[model samples]
Target: MSTTALIYEGDWVSGTSQLDEKFIGYVESMNRSGGLKVRVTQCDREDAVGTSVEAALAKVRKLPDYTPSAPEELKDLIELSLATHDKEWFDELSARLAAPQAAAEQDEEKRYRFTPYQSRLYRIAE
Candidate 1:
């Protein structure tokens, strides 16, 4: 799956409103194509930005394993993380994304690296 990271700054309401518009369009297109059903989850900014690493890790540990319904959902997750501009959150997400690729390449004895999606994400996150 391909992911593009977009960076933009504005008042919170306007910025998020624009994101919402694009997200709705994407979801509608997926629905029209009879693609995988997308489930949107909303988190408060405080929860997203203010949670401690330990608390966040604990919450993630308690959650069920993810099973993405479609490739698009993964792309959405990357894009959403980029939009937040939170370094810790972005780093954690990038590490999670790199894990599978690193595992797959371990036999080659090469360093683990970002896929293009993650590279773009890292660029924007910085």
Candidate 2:
């Protein structure tokens, strides 16, 4: 396995074992040795759920972020925020509902700078 993805604590990941067992969860802790402890949120094996499973960094990838579209969806999210007592999330959801186009534009923007593979990204002046 290649260390191509950046792994971090709290990232949602799916860990795969050598035996082909898979566990989905958020990373609880990351070790400098390229292993991590994952608090299993789900697994094919019933007993593994809610247990911490150890795995190598190469076996996991961060889950992509999700953005709910539509006024109804945003409203539903606001309700979830209220239920969870997440005031910051409530505020953000409300703002998104109020200005959905702006939020959509932001979502379309690149999250990070990209450089073409095998190509120089900078120019030198004489």
Top-scoring candidate (TM-score): 2
Superposition error at 93 for model 2 (Å) = 1.2
Give, for candidate 2, the lowest lDDT window spanning 10 residues.
110-119
**Candidate 1 CA-lDDT value:** 0.34
- In candidate 2, list every pair of residues with a backbone clash: none
Q: List residue ranges in candidate 2 displaced over 4 A.
A: 1-5, 18-20, 70-73, 101-126
User: Model 1 clash tally?
Assistant: 0
Error of 1 at 33 (Å): 46
Tell me the whole-model lDDT of each prediction, alpha carbons only: 0.34, 0.80
lDDT of 2 by residue, 6-110 (tens): 767888887684445698898888877788888888899878888888888888777776688688999988999999999999999998887967866777785
RMSD of each: 22.2, 14.7
lDDT of 1 by residue, 48-92 (tens): 232111111111111223555344565566678789876676666
